[model samples]
Target: MSLRLRLNLLVAALNLGFLGALTWLLIDNHRNSIQEEIEAAHRVTVQMLGSAAQTSPVFGPAPVVMVNFLQSLGRVRANDIRLYTADGVLRYSSPPSAYKAGRTAPDWFGGLMRSTVEATVIGLPGARIEIVPDASRAVLDAWDSMTAIFLLGLGFVAMLHVALLLFLRRLLRPTEADARRLVATTQELAENREVMRLIEAGIEQERKRLARELHDELGQSVTAIRLIATSISRSSEAPGVTQGAGKVNEIAAGLYDSVHRIVRELRPAVLEQPDLAAALADLGREWRIRNPDIDLSMVLEGDLGDLGEELTLAVFRCVQEALTNVLKHAGATRVRLAVAQREDRLEAIIEDDGQGEPNALAGSGHGLVGMRERVATLGGSLETGMRPEGGFRVSIVLPLAGDSQ
Candidate 1:
């Protein structure tokens, strides 16, 4: 059930329980009150008749005097009176009450409030007077009063329940404008992520094209220059000519090496072989050679070679960007790069022992932005901050295809 419905049901149940308990209490109190009132009225009537009966013989014939006395008397409240002669004649009886004359409480209600007081009989010389306790009128009054009170209580409870539900709906329900804004923001984010993914794919394709062009064009031209210089140096006899040709060969060789390195950086062998471990190893080896002053440590775990091309490239690029930042800005002497693949995700951390800038990650740097976009496109997350123990840290986590949305 919805929370609102559950709350409404709970409130209704509580209201009903309260009404039930209140009604029960009122019934008990009214029943007891009727019993006490009837009993008291019966007691007074019996005592009055007993005293009058004792004095009846002094005045006249007991039956005749008592009959006259009862005729003068009217119906007593909550009690009935009767006069009977010694020969079993019914001389007089109390008239029905004119107060609320046409009405009586229900039998079940009357039975509930009926008093336990018995009829009292007073004997004279030739007659007897009987007074019986009556509580029907009182019960009827109680029933009417209780019904009014219950109806009032029910109305109040119903109103309170409706008010509470209205309040809850107003408090819990989101505004239409806010809901629309949220939807728009979510769609914008999704569109931006998709665009970033497409752009990254296009950039990689361009890099591959460039790498192939440089390898086939610049690389072959440099090799040809080196081979021609070697042939010229072998064919020349003069020391000066031989030495100049030798210099040309050396320059051509250096140009060839530079072109090959650029091609490799643009499109690594790993892209074709899909071996992340070997790619990282080659990168680390070249970094060590280029920057002998800095110590770089790399740790790989799990089967990184099996990670898909996109994931592998994303991780590699992020690490490369982080290392480049460390080299250019961090002035780091030691860097530790670790990439691990777990059951359903990949985690990479790059930490550098250097003078880390606290605001480095927050800056509008393309490298950091690119890294974040790459990881986000792969259903991953990136974190960058200064380490507590000193230096900067970059952390990345990518969910595997099965683990991703």
Candidate 2:
């Protein structure tokens, strides 16, 4: 249902409940007033009857004057009176009559009034005079007042509802404009996200292409030059020429190694498929060779074959950067590397027993910044701190990817 209709229904329900409560309270007050009036009249009637009997004992002596007097009062107008004999038989009563000049209320109205036998009896030992209170006129007056109040209240609530409903409609008019703007903004954001995805994919493809070209063309050319230099140095024994050719061969070998390293850095081979663990082990082995003094211990866990290329690359880059920092800045002897996967998350920790600054990449080092970004892209977290036990620690946590195999 529409909001407007729902609000209207709620208001209507609340008003109806209020009206019902008010009606009950009014009816209750009227009933209480009737009770008080009847009780008061009963007290007075009892006193009058007692006084009459004290003056002359009509019940005992069968006084003709008192009986005729009571009959005369009954004929004109009397409270609801009934005289019962000692044997439990009705002897006399007030004549049937209307409450007002010519109107008597219906049975429902009578039922709505207070009960009848709530009044008391007043008489001698052999006689019973039941004083049935007659408050029908008062009851009718109360009913009339309640009906007027209800009609007035209902009309007022109707006008109030109409005014408030109109006000709400006017107030909500600007919301439609905001809703349209929100929809447009959401669509723009989605389009931008798709564009970013395409750009990222293109960049990855370009890196792969470049790595292939460097490995195939430049790498092969450098290898041939090194081979020819090696052959010339081995055959020719002229001391000066042999020394020069050896130097040339050594420089060529260095260039080839540099090219190979650059190609691997540009596009990691292990990231093409899953096998992230294998890639990490290879990285550790390389680092061990480079930093022989720094005792490197690797603890790799979990099958990383489920991780996607992007996630694997990101994590691998983080590990690579961390190791570079350790080699460059941290003058430590022992470096520990750990990568583990448990359930839906992958975690890697690298700590070195070196005197490295905790805030090394606070406002410096593009490498560390790039690492942080890479992990963040996959909804992961990175933490760096200096351990109290005398070491610098780098921690990384990443969400594991779905099945990519």
Candidate 3:
């Protein structure tokens, strides 16, 4: 729900709660007033009846006159006027005796008037005038007050709510506009991310093509040149001629080595294999041979080969770049590379005990950006930071479905 709607509802709820409490208090006060009215009426009636009875000159105990007086009292007071025996048996009543035990109000209303005036049970418990608290009128009066209060409160809240809505609608327009701007920015960022992914994939494919070209064309030519150098060295026995052939042989060998290194730099042949684990092992072995003075360790915990070609390639290249950075920049001697399959994801961690400052010298051109881009294209994450202990660490995570997607 919007803030305006929530606030409006809250206001309405609070109004209802407050009005309900006020209505309850009003009803309670009305009940007390009715009780007091009944008690005062009962006291006055009992005193008047006692005095009239004491002063009456009863012409041989005139019962008919007493009945007429009681009937007149009922007519004037709108109360139950009755004459009962000393044993609590009803003897006479006004407007007939049918209404003696009848209710004068609704059951809910009568329930509110729990206390009644007993009139002192004059003579005996039976021959007494009981003034029952007929709360029918009071209940109706309370009902009217409650209705009025509720309607007034609702009207007041409604008016206030309308005014607030009008004010808030104008006030929040800027916030809505800001929200729209934020949404637009988010969409632009997503489009840019997708564009970068395509660019990275293109770059990778280009590298593969270049590696293939150098391997097939330049590689063959160099092999031919090495063969010629071999033949010349064998045919020449003179020291000068032999020395020259040996130099040519040496130069050819060095050139071949450089070509091979360039090919690997472009694309490692091991990445094309189906078994990614074996590729990683081969990668670590090659690095160890290249950096004989550095200690390298690689561990594969589970069956990660099914991670597919693209994801496997990303992982391989990431590690390759990390090792290359370590070899070139880090003056440390030990490196650790670990790849593992856990649940639905594959993770790789590379750490080396070397001074790493790729981020600081990022403008100078570094492999970390390419590594990060490659990982990001797969909808994965790449983190490169210096470890607290004293070296650089790179953490990578790629979903198994990253390649398929």
Alpha-carbon RMSD to native, per candidate: 6.5, 7.1, 5.5
lDDT against the true structure, per candidate, is: 0.89, 0.76, 0.72
Local error of candidate 3 at 337, Å?
2.8
Q: Write model 2 residue lDDT over 149-227, tens digit each, in one string.
A: 9898888888888888898888867687898998888787566545654665677789889999999999999999898
- The top-ranked prediction according to lDDT is 1
Question: Model 1 — which ten-residue stretch has the worst lDDT?
Answer: 396-405
Question: Alpha carbon lDDT of residue 317, candidate 2?
Answer: 75
TM-score of candidate 1 to 2 decimals: 0.66
Compare candidates 1 and 3 on lDDT and give the better one.
1
Query: What's the distance in Å from true for residue 18, model 3?
Result: 4.4
Q: Residues 1-405, candidate 3: write the lDDT tens digits.
A: 988788778777876787778767866787787777766766676777666555433633334445556666653232445666556667656553233334245566557644465534334222544433333554555556656876887788678777877787778667877999989997886777778777867887899899889989988888888888788879988888778878887888888898888888677765566577988887888778878999998888889777777778888888888887888778988999999998878899999888865563254655888888778778788888888888889999887765422
Candidate 1 backbone collisions, by pair: none
Cand. 3 Cα-lDDT = 0.72
The parts of candidate 3 lying over 4 Å away from their true place are 1-23, 47-51, 57-65, 75-81, 85-89, 93-119, 122-128, 140-194, 216-221, 292-294, 328-334, 352-366, 384-392, 402-405
Clash numbers, per candidate: 0, 0, 0
Clashing pairs in 3: none
TM-score of 2: 0.61
